[model samples]
Target: MFAKLPFRTGTTSSAIWQGFAGSVMLLLGSLGVGWLASSSVLIRTPLFILARTTPAAVICATVLLCLGALLMFRAWLRLSQHLSGWNDDAGPVLRKALILWVAPMMLTLPLFSRDAYAYIGQGRLMQQDLDPYTNGISALNNYFLLGPDTLWTEAPTPYGPLWLWLEHLAVLIPANSPEIALIPFRLASLAGVVLLAIYVPKLAARHGFNPHRALWLAVLNPVTLMNFIASVHNDSLMMGLVVAGLYYASTKRAVVGILFVTASIAIKPITLIALPFVGLLWAGSRAGWVRKFALWAATLGISMAVMGAMGAVNGLGFGWLAALQTPGTIWHWYAPVGIGSVSLGSLVDWLGGDGTPIADGIQKVAQVISILIVMALAFVKIRLGPSGGLGADLPEPQRYSHAVMRRMAWAFTAVVLLAPMIQPWYVVWLLAFFATTGIKDGWPLRTVFYLSAFFILIALTDQLSVFPWISMEVVRSIAVVVAVMGLLYLTLWDKKTSELFKRNKPDQHAFAVKS
Candidate 1:
């Protein structure tokens, strides 16, 4: 069925076949990973009886699983390349491919994060009339039934009121069956990805980019599939709403756009950064400075009112405001500011100074610097001009849309890089924006792709635990071998071989011409 779809000029029959084969391999790998690994919160399904138990079987499954993942990654790169432009026929094809790719994962256990279990627990808290923002999952006596990871057992929910209310609804359905309760949450995440698939292309086309390529980057990318869909992260819903809001705001429906963006903020407050950009998008070149100011003010006012109404409906009030700072307490190496703080602390200690205070000071400095940089960029984007100036000849709405997307991309990057606790999925915020605006074939684009692969490995390693017989040494060895082999195959054997043939073609052409 996929073979019949209309792709761009360069798409080959071989590429389609290859991608189908890779999807099959990814399905098997997902099954292996799901079967072998135990969930921290949920009970094992009856299907887990088929999981590899012996040393040899486990090792073989591990290798196969890694190979399948790499294969899936390669296939996506090929298929995305075939997606050259906004072909109307490509939409159904992309959706079909997405389903083929994601179907196997749905049958398997959650792939990367255990946040869904936490959501279940938080929802139970809300159902019990306990404010999730102020109370942790520990507040619920039957928290064990939900199987949330201990990391968040004592931590109050940092998510916004809209999410809390959604959690309430999720927990209320199929109340007796603990195992079945999680299906709703996963479906909700799936709904979010569906929204993204629809809006990303629309936004891309409006801003004069290849909507097909944008769909590939925003939806088919491993980061989106693994973190957003498989892991069922709330960021999926937030991003979906964000993209939809941006699309509406760009199309001159400023009121509708503000409401959507506000809803996203109600899911996760970090998206509040986009509110100002939306206001600016509504204030285009045609509007005078005074009108721009008034529009901005009106946008803020309406957004706040809508949010307040949502808060009242949920009965959660504004507790999420205090909860916003909750995530910053956790630190990780992936965060630039986090690692910097640790490195600075060690340096100060080595130099016979107080390390704790110095580390704190360094973190604050990094954060302040990032904020200032974002502010400067926003000011320049608003006062001066758009970054690429590609939309100068376009309509005012399209031009302003491109400008706001570009600036928002920068701001989102700053937020991710500077945050004390960074997750693999948070990068999607910047990626969704960039994919629509158009990524240049440069270092930044390359870096994003590289990071996607790197984070996949990191997430898999963290989530997929081997049996006791496998030994930590054997597991580490397998990981190292797989990483090296995958890197070599992808970079040298696959990509380099293509480059070599292309380079040699020119010489052959020159020789033929002379002859």
Candidate 2:
């Protein structure tokens, strides 16, 4: 029913009509709430000055969120169909239209993203020459930004170089209203989005893989577009660099690959540890080690110089270096720690000991465990023979050059699983890899379905944070269940798992036959 929707790109008029109609409904719903919320409160109040959030509006907004999700599901069904070669003719136009339709999402900051305010405050701190790591926004001491609502005013951004630079731009933009301040910041992410839309598919195609599938993962995935762009997170910029780096590796541009990967590292260093292993595999014994070494050093030197220039201009003066440490800090909704805390906290508190010890212990343990595991995986990936499987059969080079590609998939999967502070959009980086994995096999329908479903559920939790009226536990519990299932699948059901252990694995022939 969903797939047969009138939104198919071949039906050019209908697709545009559907997009316009849907976007209009969403905007009207948003405006209704805005009117009501703004009606009661001071227009300039920092904490959610919803001018029109009457009781009816709240119910209506929640319903709209759910409905918008359903619409997104319908869109995904069609996208998956095109990806599986069911309607191979639909790829180009569908991907192009998707890029256009979703562009506005990146332009606007949605309600759930009070996180953007915290980002602005942190950027203000950078501009004022304060360290965001320790002082948070409080150090800025700007009453208008600090606001009456305490939590958001002082909450620090636990983001990496990619995001801090983005936030720095937002603070620099001259604007009287906070909402106006968000516009330029939102525009900044568009470059990453455009690069992703262009490169991921082209690179996949170069390897004889289904560029369409990779395109969907990077471009059309809902959680990715919403959480990163609308929510204004900088993971897109970091991940875009990774994709560019991967594309370079696929094309055998090892030197360029290392440079792009280093820039990605400069954004979020933890995500790029796997890049060195990829370089090692590509450059084995006969390859030019000296040139590669020089390339890496040059890349790091260039990125650091750029960072230094930006920092100095913002009056940051290398202070952002210290801010990178906070990226390792765990958020309450993050994995491993949040997985145990959300799931076990209730049980522990019920058991009379209070869950403080378990919660505190997991936070400390997660950081150590995550880094250790990533290092171990990098070691295994580097020692591989030309075409030998590291843990799974790599894609045929002539068929698609998925050799290094496969290792990258496993590496990305590992980081997503182990990272102490993973938000839903984090999964977007891996989703692109997973899509290529599917194409390497055959028709990976089941794997595609599960991932799409998991994406919807995780996106729901992030969107759910907005409505203060909803029972927070209700949403958190849903997140716990969804995240746990995803974690279990990545760990236990990977290609490395034997048939017995992973009874419900995706199609075996999916990746088995390439061309």
- Which one wins on lDDT? 1
- Residue-level lDDT of model 1, residues 218-297, one tens digit each, is 78886787787667788988999988998998888989999889888888888888887887888875667687678878
- Model 2 RMSD vs true structure: 7.5
Q: Report, for every candidate in turn, its global Cα lDDT versus the true structure.
A: 0.70, 0.54
Candidate 1: residue 125 Cα off by (Å): 1.2
TM-score of 2: 0.73
Q: How many clashes show up in model 1?
A: 0
- Residues 240-321 of candidate 2 have per-residue lDDT tens digits of 7777776776566765766676666656665556465545444543346575465445555655675566556655455545
Q: Candidate 1 at residue 471, lDDT?
A: 71
Reference-based TM-score of each model: 0.86, 0.73
- Runs in model 1 deviating more than 4 A are 1-46, 49-61, 83-89, 142-145, 175-179, 349-354, 380-389, 442-444, 465-473, 495-515
